[model samples]
Target: MGEKTLPQAGQRGAIPEKQAWKALAALCIGLFVTLLDQSLVAVSLPRIREELGASINQVVWVSAIYLLTFAVPLLITGRLGDRYGQRNIYLIGMAIFTLAAFACSQAPTIEWLILLRAVQGFGGSLINPQPLSIIHRIFAHNRRGAATGVWSAVASSAGLFGPVIGGVLVGTVGWRWVFFVYVPLGLISLVMVARYVPKLPTGTSRIDLLSGLVSLIAVLAVVFSLQQGPELGWTWWVWVVLALGVAALLLFIRMQRNNPRALVPLGLFKYRNFSLGAFAVGMLGFTVYSVNLPIMLYLQVGQGMRAETAGLMLVPMGVISVIMAPVLGRLTDKIAPGLISKIGFSAMIAAMTLFGILMHLQVTPAWLLIAIVLLGLANAMCWSPNSTISMRDLPPELVGAGSGVYNTARQVGAVVGAAALGAVMQMGVDSFSFGAAMGNALLLPVVFLLAGLLAVSRFK
Candidate 1:
């Protein structure tokens, strides 16, 4: 199969490997800038709060709203890449994100910031799934792992690197600079995409607008209820909204199963690796997003570390991930992903659990670094293999749908993680020592990672 010629979407013959890789690099820059921009925002949260006079709850919305908006539109956006050209869709989304970043920096209040972040999230959703489609279209099935590895490396490393860059921006300039810092990177990504990424052929798949709206409402309801439950005292209305969200979600699933224009083609889940990959990545999303703000808050507010120092403390995560992704990415092409992901999930579980334990105990700060290192290792192993395993087997026509579903799972996990953690942290802070509150909140990710581990354990 590797020996057979596979043409690019608009070509007569095989797309040169060099051209495929160059296009992937262009996509990586866009992914990296967005992830870096978002992750860096965590380090700036305290500063954002101080300047805007936002309550801790309002602060959580800055992150949660982004994830919620980002997650809900993804299925549609994935199809957008299929129906319109990936490069064209990517350019439009990147333009929106860059403009929104500038708008976010200019926001005078927390409400404004939150609103702008939503626009930014929607833009990110458009950007996220294109790489999946383009990579699959351009790379052969057997070699997809290596291409995916490069993509995953940028994605994972960007999140890790965000804090370090964010700390510097926050410490020297201000919180607004964190958003401002990305404008140039975004512009550069736009230029590179224009220069490198090819215009792939669009598919005939029609998007299901009704299903999209239903899915959005379901996600918004659940995330809103979780985020506001503590503030609202978990009132009757909160439970009502939560229940409605669950019911609506079930309805959406049923709708997809029957609807020909389904946002998620339920049939795709029939592939075991695809199903497990989506599940595992969701757990990863839950853990990764849930842990960030709490750790930043714990270190900055609880331990009183300087923003730059605290950001620097977490740099090892990105550093380790960057060093290991290429190696592990290649490994996914040869080895059993089940074994690789097991090692990753175990490390993640240990790291988050240990973080909670030590934070609850208020142990010395140095001890926490060990957990960070584990997280880095977990990130390196989890992203590439899971991504490689998930979509490589799909028919080319289904790549966009598969990517959308896979990424939606991830962002949905992120949405739940951020919301649930916010609620937990708010409760913990009220009743316990700050460190203990953060420590307890860390356990949520453990439960998520454990679930993911069990899912991947069934992989062939």
Candidate 2:
């Protein structure tokens, strides 16, 4: 009787392992295009500013608004996946994102572009959390890491080629092509998801709408203050808004604590690994999202390298990351603790420390490239293994909520990291030489990596 009813509750028990892997691949591809669009658009921003006759301030919104819309609502979207169905939410997101991309391509003005990008980003949020939940539902425990490893690898690889691809697209075909390219990829993902990914059982019954609202407002204010702070002078009002955001965030936490069926599921934190994993991922988010700024500034502005050459220097990091993620995932399936992630974070610190020293000592590009390779391997270890370990002990019922909270933490870290690094970079640039300023900024990642290392070290 249990076996007979199992297909309706969560269908993966009836899914063949080979077919489940196919579903995971399709989901990963969907994840790929969304991530690719982010890096792709970033490369096109300068051209966008030139063509649209926009100021630097207005142009930054083209990027900032997308990030704001995407990161802020992830908590809600994740629960939406559980309340509805992962496949349904993913298909809807792909359609919305694809449509937004097409609209963005034809946008006549910067304002239109910004508005459409927000739509595009919201679509992305809808797609992001579904994959993890889908993976959990379709694959059994022992096979999950290998499945997650491939997911992690493809995810890392998506950005690896983005700069090169974006540069080529923007240079040859025009900035519009960057947005146009995704129309087909999005459509393909929509079809693939429709055909390949199964609709999983909805796990969540009630969503904390009030908590979601508070979080949205608080995150919006905080992210706005941070994104605009450099331009807006961090005035008295900005400080006031920032403080209110913090207070609202605290209130959201309190609300979650009081609500038994909270969207966030505080019970997940009862497992020591989940709490530590969530924290570690946040630190990883901080480093991964912000580290690029100083490196690019150092190479392009300070060292006088061509844009192509400077972008090429980072390729080693991407290459190693792609190669190592699945291997790390396989290791994660075998190990209960985060021994691998701990070592990875440690290597990450070492890599950043070496890279920073090389920059300060004015080393050649060749040596710095080698340092980046080490950073790549370290990052590879951190991402897949850490993610696998985080969810390893999660309750089956709270999987969707866990994915939501975990990823929300990751994006929150990314948002905060980018803002923190920008502030630090600005301060350093003001007080020191170009190289010195960038070098100091580079040190920031090492500090975050230290925190990540400490988090994983406590894994038991």
Candidate 3:
């Protein structure tokens, strides 16, 4: 009765181990693409600007558009996966992403490239939620941290290599190869999804189209305002967009109360751990996206490093995160998750503070390398275990919707963080000392790290 009700496959009450690894592999592919997309663009941005004759605003938009689109659709798509089928939705997203990559590579104009990038973001939104949703369905609770740890490792490893790979491709072959490079990997993943990614039966609830609309409007308005505010000088549109977004959010919450099949189930937040854990994940997302772009810009412009060289500098951080996540996940089961998360948050704070000091002194390669190592270790500590704790106590039926909400928060936070940080750096370009903008950006991560520590306190 438990096995039948649980939606997990067990032979006379024992979950099979082989299927777990298969799910992990499929998830790794999805994560690799997502993380790779974020980092690969870092080193390639300058080249992209030069070839396409893009201004600083347009260049930044390349990253911005991707993140904004990526964040918006995650909740809706995740629920759609639960309702339609995780396997099917995931495959469709991958197909769209792979083909979109080709379109991005061939784009003859900057406008065309940006447009395609928006399309790419939409496709990406579908990818992030399904893998974790699949994991939640397949893995039993006791072993989930270990599973998430492996998934986190793959994500970090891909993030680590993306810049290096993008740098090399941009320097030797051309920026076009950055997009073209994902082709074979996508093809392989498509095959894997077809063969290994199992399909759950479609759910019965009707799609909540209105709720999805309000959510999207709210998210887009806020994202646009934040991204454009520094550049636009607090225009009416900024205020209007933000106000509309806030209003839309209120409406979304009101609608969710009545809609039985809401995109994000409000009831999931009734669980204290789940609510706090989701907020912490959002803060972590804020830290990562906020930190990454500025560091990339500084590496290339301020430090006088080539795209590839700067990318290689980030290698240590990526490597440590990849190596530590799974190991830490396994340890989480034996130890308390809150302790693990506290340690992780502490590491991140230390890394960010040290990075601030290093940037103030000089933007040297050695300093960057040391900071990367610390950042990677910190990332490994926070993400995997925090994710484990986030969903630890939820009912099985709620996992899919919960994964959607959790992922949506993460994606939305990343978008907001990137926008805010980008604005700070731009303002820093004019208002403060040489290092002021970068230093100001560090405040974001510090605040998030503190918040994470506070949230982890509630984990048990």
Candidate 4:
């Protein structure tokens, strides 16, 4: 089969092999940073609380606020990239992220740290969407699986190592250095993108700033309401804020449907695959991040594991995921994506069920460690294949939008999972049992997997 060709920027010729590799490397770094940030704070949360004198709620925002900021702007940013140029947006985002990391390191108060995390989220929003855009522009369909496989593998493995690395850094250097770790990586990634990322101009439209603003308001209100509801007793004002948020979202959707220069073209949803795939991605993202945060708590706080030891215990899962993700991604391209997705989801179910049962029984450390490793293997298969399958069916024109849309699900899920599961465990709603809270959280992945199975079954 011949390589598929897409239009290039400035009427340039075909993308060269070296340029594609460079773009991939830059993209991998961006993906790694985003995923790393997702879990890197887990081990350090206690330290941050002690140093910053953060309350339970304030500390959660250190994580939740970042996710809310990240998730809310993705679709808008993706569209902005299309309108203003992805390379420029990506470069700007990296710079912002780097600075935000520095700010986070210097933060002396929990509020300051939370604010900096929000800044990091915004920067992350810019960085995360462009990689898929680059992949769509540069790689032919025949090569996309291998290319994206590598991308997915790098991203998934980052989650495995991020906490471990954060743990060690907190134990040795300080928790602040976790934020600083991105500086050198960001600098290197910036150079790669500047040289290799093609500078495609905005086609015709300016960024629909009004639409972006509305989205920001809506998501922020909703996320804030959700995050605070459990603690605040879900008062009338919380409900009011949430209701207003829903209304704003509805209004935003209406605006997008009617606007000539919509931030995200409403028509993208016409693709059955894109719609269903995005849903699956969202649910999967929620389950994945949810698993990371509480598990860290269980290991460190519940079991009294040292930061370094916890980090070491997580290594097997990282290794397994790193090895398995690419393999599953490659499999996604050939055998039915749904079948692969189903298998992956099934693995997730097994992993979560085992985890809940083992933790409930207060199993021995050796056995518990084994369970965590198995969970990693299951996650490896689920995450990569699911990501590959979700994006595979998009038209070239829709690729950039698809990237943003897909990631939005991931981020939103992370926020929701963290907030929702945290509430359950902290409030003792899940039987005052950490194991029960975990079991309840595991149900989310099961539901998402079932939905993925249905999506795959309906595949044309």
Candidate 5:
């Protein structure tokens, strides 16, 4: 298969081994920029709030809106890649994301920044799934685990490093540079994609626009309700929105069941590995997103570390994940992914538990770094293996749909995590000290990681 002939334009064929790896690199560049932007705003949020004279709720919306918009459209955009070309859609998405980043850097008000971030999210939704789908298509099953490992490593590293980069930029140049930083990265990714990523065969199935709209609405409503609930003091409207979201979700499920060309095929759920793997990934997202901000706050606010120093503390997580991902990815291909994931989740649970205890006690930086390193190793173990296992059994035709569904689950988990953590921190502030609040909030991710462990346990 490695020596097989290449496809002519508009068709699928075996990409030569050299070209396939190059394509993976290009895809990873794009993935890195997108994931980096997701967390880049974290350490800079306070600066953004102060500079723009924004209220706390408005500033939180800056992050929440991006997650919400990004999560909502993933179901449809994955199909867009399938029906159109993944390469083409990726290029378009990258372009929009780049342009949006520039606009975000120029925003004169918090509302403008929030609106532009949503645009960035829209672009991100289009780009997120294509790499997974492309990797699934281009690599032989035996080699895919390693490719996905590289993919996971790039994403995880970007996420961990974003705050560091954001801190340097925010502390020195300004927060706007965080958005400006993406412009060059996006251009490099665009060039790489255009030059290396081959045009794959496009699907002919009709897109279920109604089902997609329903799904988007449901997600938006639920995320809005959760994100605003604490800020609004759990108003009557919050429950109303939550109920409406649930109702919309049921309707979306019904629509999916009836449509042969659903954005998310109901039949994909029949595969136990995919279902469980997706759930576990969502839990992973929940843990990461929910815990990250509080940790940053604890380091900078409670411990009185500088933003740059606080950001540097997370370097171990990225470095360890980069080093360990390929090893774990290769291992994933040879072992039962469920077992590896169980080990990973155990590490994560232990790390988070230890982190909470240490933060509550105000331990030395050495102990905190140890916990971060453990979390990084756990990240390396979990992401690639879960992704490889989840999509291993998907038919070629379902790859795009499955990728979309998997990414949607992860992003939705992130949105919910951010919201739940916000609410928890708010409660803590009202009842106790901020440090204690953050420590209490850390326990939630442990619960999420444990839930992920339970999900993966069902995987054969």
Candidate 6:
């Protein structure tokens, strides 16, 4: 069969292994660029703030809006993939993301940057879920765990190396270069995906636009309130927004229950592992995205390190994750996924707690580097295993939907982390030194991880 004529859905047993791996590579490249953009901008935030003359809120929104837009449309986008084709939607997303990256580099003001970031995020939302869904369709059950491991490794590696790349660009060329750098990468990924990734058969399921709108409104209200609450002195409007968010969420759930074509089928939660895995991944997202900005600030602002030096400090974490992810991924196939994930969550909790304590004491670089290494190990164990087990039992036809929900949970957690942590950090800064504020903010990840641990406990 030609590249465009793939085996039908649920017929992965027939696809050639060589083509499967090539498709995996194409998907990883797409995933890498999108995830790289997520972390790459983080280290450059301070530079962007200075150049754009943005306030703290605006600076955080640069990150938050991207995540927010990325998170909200995932449910619909996943269904779109099912209706269209995963490879088709992924290519479209890559094209949009690449163009938006160029646009972001030329944005003249913070507001324009935020708007462009939102567009970039829309492209990301299109690209993010298809890889996992495609992997599920093309890879055999025996090797799916390993595929997820590779997927997780690419994501973690992006997170790890993004700051270093950003630091180099922001320090040497300019902050705008951070956005410009991804344009070429995105173009390359687009070409690879079009050439290599098989065109999977599409599903005929209709998407529920109302559920999508509700989800967007709910997430926006809640995240905006949380991010602005501390700065705004927790006014009545903040509480009002929070309440509106909660109400909208309830309405969304009710609508999902009533609609046969729900954006998120409530039935997916019937499986204990899927439910638990979703929660755990969300916690991981919260910790991973929330922790980066504070760590960058602590390194650059609090310790008086250069952007390049601060970015380099994160290299060990990435290195460790890159080394360990595949090993853990293969192990996930043999081991009880819950057990592997529990070990990961425990290690991450310990590492984050240590980071909090070390920051409180203002420890030397050596101690901090050790903590970062531990964090990397924890990350390697956490993401792939949780992802593997979450969809382990999902029906083949629902793979696209499941991937969407799983990714949506992760991104929503990220949105919460960025906003809520920003608020917490602001509060801490108001009452204490920058180091103390960051130290205090570190505790939030610990709390999120503990909650994840609780969810993982229910996995078996």
Q: Among all windows of ten consecutive residues in candidate 2, which has the lowest summed lDDT? A: 1-10
lDDT of 5: 0.84
Model 1, span 1-460: residue lDDT tens: 1222334543221366788788888898888876676577877898899999999988977976776677777778888887776788899999999999999999999999999999998898889899888888887666787888888878777876777888788888998988887799889889988877766656646688889888878877876786567667889999999999899899999898877777778888888999999999999888885677898789899999876787788888888887787788778878866888888888888888889889988977788999999889989888888888888887766788898888878777776787789788988999999999998899878888889999888887
Candidate 4 collision pairs: none
* Every model's TM-score: 0.91, 0.95, 0.92, 0.90, 0.94, 0.92
Query: Across residues 2-79, which tens digit of lDDT does each residue of candidate 4 receive?
Result: 323246522232376577877888878977897788788766888999988889888877887777777788888787
User: Following a full C-alpha superposition, what root-mean-square deviation does model 1 have from the true structure?
Assistant: 3.8
Candidate 2 per-residue C-alpha lDDT over 1-460 given as tens digits, one digit per residue, 9 for 90 to 100: 1211124323343367887877887788778887776566778889999999988877788888888888888888888887888888899998998999999999999999999999999999999888987777777777778777887776665665677778788878999999999888887777777777765556677777788899888888787787777678889999898898899888888888868668787788898888998899889878776777788778888889876777788888888888889888988888867888888999888887886788788766777887788888987888888778788557667777888888878877878788788888899878988777777777887878898899999988
Model 6 TM-score (2 dp): 0.92
* Model 4, residue 71: C-alpha shift (Å): 1.8
- State the C-alpha lDDT per candidate: 0.82, 0.81, 0.78, 0.75, 0.84, 0.83
How well is each residue in 324-399 modelled by candidate 5, as lDDT tens digits? Answer: 9978888888886688888988999998898888878877666788899999999998887889899977877788
RMSD of 5: 3.2
- Model 5 TM-score (2 dp): 0.94
Off by over 4 Å in 5: 1-13, 432-434
Best by TM-score: 2
Q: Write the number of the candidate with greater TM-score, choosing between 2 and 5.
A: 2
Please give the ranking of all candidate structures by TM-score, highest first, separated by commas. Answer: 2, 5, 6, 3, 1, 4
lDDT of 5 at 373: 92
The best candidate in terms of lDDT: 5
Q: On a 0 to 1 TM-score scale, where does candidate 1 land against the true structure?
A: 0.91
Candidate 3 segments exceeding 4 Å error: 1-6, 9-15, 54-57, 156-158, 429-433
State the lDDT at 313 in candidate 5.
Answer: 94
Report the lDDT of model 1 for residue 143.
72
Candidate 3, clashing residue pairs? none
